[model samples]
Target: MSEITPADFALFLLASGDMQPRKRARDQQADLAGLELKRHVLDLIVSYAPPADALEATLMQIAQEIGPPYGPTRALCASIRDEFADAASTPGFMEWLIEEAVRENAGQKEKRRGKTFNQ
Candidate 1:
């Protein structure tokens, strides 16, 4: 594998925001999943950026990287919909908008479930 330079790693950290760790620390195997998800998001955002001009190309890349969100990722997105909703209106925020919708539907369904007891 090609070695990653510190500058590249720094850029990744910048792109990933709060997802990747900032300092060296003991990490578990399960931690890899979150890191991977962050990287996937970063990749999509970068690819979708205006200068890149490759939304179509990045869509395929994102699909290959993330596939359809599965159990945990779907659940995570659903749980954190409020946090992501602000970004939904951004130009390249389609995927996140989808997740926001997922979370919205999930929340609406939950509310309906609660109302069913009253009715």
Candidate 2:
């Protein structure tokens, strides 16, 4: 948990698409429970510096534009609430976030495509 940073959280949010700006917050306000762990994890990532890549920028923008303004964790909670409102809880959600961090740090994921020039 201590090892997790804000940038990592943003990356997780971005990759998971849990904080998309297009989503409506009112839709999820009803089931805003069981977000304590996510809130804790989100707090850790506040001071983290995201990578200087397109994905990071995109995530930052989404967070900034959301209703809470740079509150990716809030957006994430809302999303989870909307998607899993009926279910009490789901195990391994945090574990999946950890796996994303490991994969990111190890560069195990595929590389992003860049602009190409004709030879």
For each candidate in the order shown, give its overall lDDT on alpha carbons: 0.47, 0.44
lDDT of 1 at 81: 33
Model 1 ranges off by over 4 Å: 1-17, 22-27, 49-65, 76-81, 86-119
Count clashing residue pairs per candidate: 0, 2
* Among all candidates shown, the one with the greatest TM-score: 1
Question: How do the residues 69-119 of candidate 1 rate in per-residue lDDT, one tens digit apiece?
Answer: 555555443333333333333554444434555566677689899999989
lDDT of 2 by residue, 18-56 (tens): 422345657654344324334444443444454323334
Model 2 clash pairs are 5-45, 6-45
- List runs of model 2 lying over 4 Å from the truth: 1-77, 80-88, 108-119
Task: Specify the highest-lDDT model's number.
Answer: 1
Model 1 TM-score, all chains together: 0.33
